[model samples]
Target: MASNIHYQRADYESGLDENSPLITGLTGRKPELKSRDGTASAMATFGLGFSIMWAQALIRWFASPTEFQPAPILGPDVIEPWRLVSLRIFEALSVGVLLAHIWYCVLVPAFPYLRNFKATDEPHQFTLDGRHVLGGLVALCADGFLNCHQYIFMWNANSINRGVWAKFLPFHNHLSSSRYGESLLWGPPMYVYFCAGFGILGCNMAKPLRKRFPDLSNAGIFTIIWCIEFVMDFVIENLAIRITHGYGYAKTYRPLTLFPEQVHQFPIYESVFVASLGLVFTAMRLKAYDTGRSPVEAGFEIWHPSLQGTVRTFAVIGFSAGAVLIFYHLPLNWLGVIGDCYADMPSYMKPGPVE
Candidate 1:
């Protein structure tokens, strides 16, 4: 039987045999090809599926709301008038920092040298490309998604563990839908900016460490990066908690916390889990810059040149978001689920109602 099917030379180049059943099965349409290396695609698909299931589980948990309880006898509000004022000031500074980052991104093309200023620049850095900026943006959005889990697992765990933001913020008490409103607004910009700086610190610090111990592996270097992230996260989280009285680990198990006797103690595990988020993001950005393409961008060449940019962007976002789900959200939420219900919390630490 004579057939009308036609195959191009490119099909062979793409490693697809014209006589293969997979190719033959697609009779009329152009057979879209994917990368022969399927690791990134597989991981991304798995991560996305896991993330959806995790989100569904969290939604169910929020509907019932158990594990932690509000202090029976409320004291005074922990957030003082001065702390509110300070929080407003901090938010304003955050706005300025975000603006500066935007401006930097805008200028990077015109001033090509500015790429060296990006946080992921190692001494032996690759030439900065659009992928670096794209990686940062993806990390920013992914980190925001990662941070929103706190609203469900930390803030809303107990009536007393609620987050208290300045009233000026639009999403302050907006918890009717997903409890992520406030975190979605604040988390991405804040965490991305700080993580960039932390990446710079890690890169610079690595030079000395590498020279000191010439035989250090990439895993060893990342372990150091993880430690740096953990320490920085610890300091920043404690300061934010104490200064703004923004939120508390009211239901954290006392024996596992840093300051077990203190009313506003931090859980040691929080920093450990959160730091992994930064570590994954930093590794991704560094890899993107080094390889001139993200791990998830592997199969992107199959797309048209015009669409490749957009496709790669989404791929980076999906991969980073998946990494966040696996590394950050799972561990932190697991700990939150098993937290103790503390009844002796101070009034300030106990946020009474959702409003």
Candidate 2:
């Protein structure tokens, strides 16, 4: 009986095309394709984002008369000259990375071999790969989702401000002048680059863990991803806060933070919830790739071939954005509103107007 079952399974497998989405999804099979190591791919993607920053900073340094100002130890109460330069450089770099990533997505269709360049071994879809585009869209949506609450409570109460760069960044005195406005402009793309890099890292990390412990369930893998993301967030956020003094967490619950009394207060929960952004983005992309259709794109087959491409594109964005809202933003917003506030918070820790 066992031999008969084994023979039947072999026969069934041999009959299905390895590249067919139907077989891949039904049998829980990953597409057979040459791929690079996940860690290396993740690092490359991440490095690209930072490379853009360095390139921009170098150009700005040479082109303009601006000089690099040393960051003050006590932390500036306002947007110091150095801080403004740092913010401008970083924001422009983020925009540059966004445009570059978008261009890569556009080129992927004409050059399907780009799949080999990403973290996955999965074969490219017939046209544009939804997985590649999903990361940025989700980040964009998640930014909007979290900002809605931050704008209402934090910005309105002046509990948080963009420091002094608001008036100085390109569009002076316009809606884009505010910190939130700048965030609205550049934050999504920054997050997209972040998620693309880290999300792939999480997926790559999971492969080894799964091999070592075959019994580990999906929940266990996700918990591991969450922990790694938390650590990454903690390290990155602290560096940004300490180095640039661009922004600080002023109203955080004291016990759940590092250096809560200092100007660069680091809220533990900020990392705790925000870490899920990459985790969810990775999971969604993997699931969609494995299943050959995202949950939101279920009825995609009914559309005509001409229109199906457009439908699929919207579906990918909608699915990913919705997932981010449910998984990352909802919980983060709740914690931000309830967990981060303290009425007696020190004035020095709070951000002053961007003069």
Candidate 3:
């Protein structure tokens, strides 16, 4: 009997040891595993959603959330008071929807890679890759909302009030103006660039994941890039805000702008939450890379989704910062170059009514 077992079980015993299972007196065929399918994917998604919801709820509960407040340094002339309320409504709705969608669609797929969200070895049919691309759309929507709001705010602030600049602080008005055209040029184009570029990358990357790098099993690289962008935005924005508005302004500020200063004023809970999400995204991305299978495999795996989702985000903010720092230095240095254009230009260029 033992000889028969050795002969017949040669394939299974090549790597076996004493610890192997004992043979049963009676035997029966093991059942086949059901294939992976959409239902399994949806269940995984639901669990992820629940965890995120609870986490966000807990964070919000501890910190008193702030409303949006817009303070255009150009003053009332450029940013009309009447428009402020409407803009705030739009900003809030846009941000809420964008955030919710990202968490629901993109982040959920990554749950399986996380130890906490792991399921049994059930087979799954759904690709769930669409969620990754969907993330880019959410990000683009966020960019658009911010751009339109900023443009409207700048136009009104510059046109409406005469003394608004003097009332706010020194550099606030200047920063606002710099952000306008940059947002316009970069904002809309980003939507298309992200969706198209990453869409292609994701499709190609999925092929090798099953065999070469199964760990590259989750959300892939796009998610990670956006996570990085989230961190960069928080740090950079606050610093820029401080530089433009005096340190004093950071204290009393409410939410007219899409960002709520009140939220920033307290225990830093908001910052932590944002940072945590970024880290989670990054972790998922690495999992998608699956231990660096190959350059092309990694490229196909991580590059596009991360790029489409995050590159534009950082670029837009970076462009805004660059505009402020560089433009401030060069006044006029041409054939007819002269002194300060803001002070010397005609009434139209100067802004405000004729003196």
Candidate 4:
């Protein structure tokens, strides 16, 4: 049976083969019949992220097993009122910085949509290939799973951060950086986001949906994928978090978090974040393509991005991460758990007067 998409004989000279199974119709990259290259190259880039997350988890597990766990009891709330304010500010900044890392990775290759001027610029053509997909996976791990630089100041309970600025967001202050189980939970967000958002939607599932319906256009296909990704992310993550933390219907890990209410709903928040981001980029790219604007076809240009794009990008990422932090600490700011996390440390962990 002839395929709906026009396929071409392999063109060895230019290193393209439209005849291959991976001839994608996603955003950008079009020369009438350019081969999207072997799907093997694209597919191979995935799953490496899951491995990296666990590998880091193992290294931390064996070499620094307890390092991921909470610090010992500290002097009960002796850190002083002013210091807590400072700590909160620093931690928020850290979150924003880390989110920027994630934002750049997934949004850059798809940057054509951020353009205000629709003029032809050959130097900056944005195309999604094997490299961008693989690179995105790595970035998600570094920023989303690993806590960015949360490890920099993680020492012992007594003195986690020696430097003046280190007091805020000490390793013990966060959950994922402390416990093995929590760390595992952190790994899934990015892995699920990339795998479902990009890999499955743009590749594995797009074809079948198109075939069964016959009337589904690329836009129709994308909308279908977007909805599916959001639902799957929400359901899968909630189960994974609940199982890894307790495996039963009890408050096993609720004690692990400073705010149980916020923790329970976090899976829903993250699912929306990832899903919306994927669609935003897709819509932007599609707009550019529809407008008949092409990417830089030649030399590298100045590489300037629009202010609106920068603001909008950060807004989405900021809300995604910031909402969790705010809710997680709202209870902490009031009545904190005695030995829950470093943020709520018991006596002895603080250097001030002993209780």
Candidate 5:
């Protein structure tokens, strides 16, 4: 009886009494509780159910079916000596950057005891009331899946290459602009990175292991997420060049087919989706820290005490910008690097001509 009485009193105090208009009025502003308000606002912002409407719109706007150009038949052994050397040099530089990140991020701090380690849990981190990490993941999945489909069409058009899955990569042409002669090297690698790296990162984030490591405090889930994001970009874009082209062991690198304008728009959708996802996670990290959790306690927190909130605010902004810059500039960078290398090569060994 006393328990029931206490419950009734609490209900009244929280504005849940039968006569309280706050309880029934849909638009009235009631005294907001953190959990309730946060949950409501998050759902409003990134509701899983709500995204479907927009997803369909994006599909309609972007996924235009188009014919592709046929690929030229060429053998790897036919590649000139100087062009081969240039590609090797570029590969070495990429490998160096990736190796450095692994040593610093994975080996240096996490070695020996393997301290602060955890996979990211999407359901726990991205619930309607939780971090909404899943919303970001869905965006990535959508961007990746659609881009892959588009590439599939590109691969199909080339009589030289097999169907989508049969070729190592499809839509290799859409990676960079055809503005300069540099399109040869830049076009394919970029999308390969998007397809392969993001594919792994997305898969890792959605893994069951990530779910088991629910508490962010015990491990650096955010760092893991960031690293995965970076590496996948390299793999899908850079290394994918080798995979499809068959460098080192392969006989040739040739475009299977060219993608039309519509499919090339993947970067726009991917940039938006990933940016939104990162923002939601940053909010969660801040929310956890705001509750007096230390960076150590809030495993996702990446800054020190004095600068936690401020740093995160900036980092989120920087990361969002970085994503845009990457999507915008990487293709350009790849083009320049590839072209400069090509231009520097002897005229007899240029990409368009062979000795």
Candidate 6:
């Protein structure tokens, strides 16, 4: 079963996953995924959507229940057994998406400038191989490591509920009551995860064949998709709040970051990420179909919808932390374009001991 699923499953789906679509739709063109330069060979554009959902499943399932009423805790808030395992898993999955994003957005578009490489040719260029897996893993290491910076000065930057960096460093609980925090699950970071996950899917999961899926070029599809995901996440979050009663929810802050402040980034990060990737996907001419070429190193010879056959993820954590940190500063200081995105010092949080 595994072999058949892995080998035979790696087939070219009808236009990479697009099904029936009417010309009456937005683009006023036939239902077809556009072909471009750096399209992923291994990914079944339609299958990629499932993979994005797969990444979120880990984070959502292991997530600690949120309480409707305000709550606080010392140390980190891990959802019991899930703990570091879920966080790390989420990281690896996100990393793969990140790598794919970079490739589509940066590499393919810039290929002309580079003397060494040309548009992918033959089976190696279009099909999946080890490079796909390595890219995600390598991103995991690089991204996983930089987040260490948050540990020393946790107070200075904007942060997520159970942000990857905080968990990696093992948050110190000074005033167990006051440091209020959960080490495993929270809103901001999780929201970012979905945004990235879906964004990645939308970017690379389109089929090149006409009528297999809707046209990837249509901005309306992505907009509707993004809106749907946000609503779904919000509803589920509320459900978690209801299910666990008040204990699962985050109202005020101790160390466990909550919404309003953290919530703003939800749209900001998602909008930017999706917009950037969309531009990259089109500009780079990423193909939804395989080039059916050969390159120096082939993609992982697995049948996963993602870049590689394995479901490794590890990139989003570093990006989430860094994104909050950087954006928090970028707007306030230099650009002065945006307003406040971060919370004040721990001393500001009430109901518990302050510094």
For lDDT, the strongest prediction is 1
Error of 4 at 316 (Å): 20
Q: What's the CA RMSD for each of the models?
A: 11.9, 13.2, 19.5, 19.3, 17.4, 20.0
Tens-digit per-residue lDDT, 186-259, candidate 4: 33334324432344344456667779879878878887877876787666646543322211111112343423
Off by over 4 Å in 3: 1-34, 37-74, 77-134, 139-234, 243-267, 291-355
Candidate 2 residue 74 C-alpha distance from true site, Å = 18
Q: Give stretches of model 2 more than 4 Å off.
A: 1-85, 92-100, 110-181, 184-186, 339-355
TM-score of 4: 0.33
Per-residue lDDT tens digits for candidate 6, residues 1-355, read 6666653334444543234354435464323333222223333342344334334433542363431112243333323333334434444554565555446543544453333465554232321222232222222321222222221112211112322322222232333322323222232233333434443444444333223555544555445444555455556444433332211211222232234343111223323433443332222223323443222112323325564433211122222233333433232222211323342223212222333
> Residue 325: error of model 3 in Å?
33
Instruction: Compose the digit string of candidate 3's lDDT tens values, residues 1-355.
Output: 6666544334454566554547642234222212221122332233344334434533442352221122223332232344444434433543554454444434554443432466645333112233333333333322212212112211222222122211122222333332211122222223322332323333344445435666753455344444544455456445522322211111211222233333223213223333433333333333445542111122222235645223323222222222212221111111012211111111121223311
TM-score against native, each model: 0.61, 0.57, 0.26, 0.33, 0.27, 0.30
Candidates ranked by TM-score, best first?
1, 2, 4, 6, 5, 3
lDDT score of residue 58 within candidate 6 = 36
lDDT of 2 at 160: 24
- Model 6: residue 311 alpha-carbon error in angstroms: 20
Better of 1 and 4 by TM-score: 1
What are the per-residue Cα lDDT tens digits for candidate 5 across 163-212? 11111122334442111121223233332223223433444563443587
Ranking by lDDT, best first?
1, 2, 4, 6, 5, 3
lDDT of 1 by residue, 1-355 (tens): 3577785555565566656556455555444543444344554454445445445544543454331223232445344668767656655666676556555544555455566765543333222223333344444433323223233222311222222222212222344223322333234455545445454456667678779888999899889888988998888778866676555565565556776545457888888876776666566556666667656667766557786555555565466555555666566655654666342344534333443
Better of 1 and 5 by TM-score: 1
Clashes of 1: 2
Total backbone clashes of candidate 2, pairs 3 or more residues apart or in separate chains: 2
